[model samples]
Target: MKVLTANRLSDGIAVWYADGGWAETVTRADIAHDKAAEDRLEAIGAAAAANNEVVDVN
Candidate 1:
């Protein structure tokens, strides 16, 4: 499995993709079973990164 991860813009808190959004813990991260889904997740995450809402999303 794979998950998207980053830091929150407000406080640089560690966060991960969860239930269609970002969350503060990996335990809440959404599961991605394949490369395609992971890519889609990354795309969404990249938006946050671009907005400076997060950093180092992967």
Candidate 2:
């Protein structure tokens, strides 16, 4: 249930993290078990933000 969520930077489309990237479906969600795991996921989100690939990920 703990998966990263964000809006695509290009058009602000809703998105989620799956496998090693962002996806358009919850079915592709990358679940996180704990804070540490979430932090790892956060790293990906941060990278996306820095690259202008996503925004407000959590």
Candidate 3:
């Protein structure tokens, strides 16, 4: 299983995480404000969290 994470760095940088750890670091300038990206990431995170909880419960 893989999950995506976005973090803001001290220098005002936004990075995206992929299968491995952090795939690459990008400046805020590189990415535009996209609500769809936020929605998608949230959805994926929720699904992954639910899956993990299920395994723990069983």
Quote the positional error of residue 31 for candidate 1 in Å.
1.0
The Cα error of candidate 2 at residue 11, in Å, is: 1.5
- Model 1's alpha-carbon lDDT is 0.87
Q: Ranking under lDDT, best-scoring first?
A: 2, 1, 3
Candidate 2 structure quality by residue, lDDT tens digits, 10-38: 88889999988889998889999999888
Candidate 1: misplaced stretches above 4 Å?
none
Clashing pairs in 3: none
Least well predicted 10-residue stretch by lDDT in candidate 2 = 1-10
Which lDDT values do the candidates have, in the order given? 0.87, 0.90, 0.40
* TM-score, cand. 2 vs. native: 0.87
Better of 1 and 3 by lDDT: 1
Candidate 2 regions exceeding 4 Å error are none
* Error at 40, model 3, angstroms: 0.1
Candidates, ranked, TM-score: 2, 1, 3
- Better candidate number, 2 or 3, judged by TM-score: 2
Q: Which stretches in model 3 have alpha-carbon errors above 4 Å?
A: 1-33, 53-58
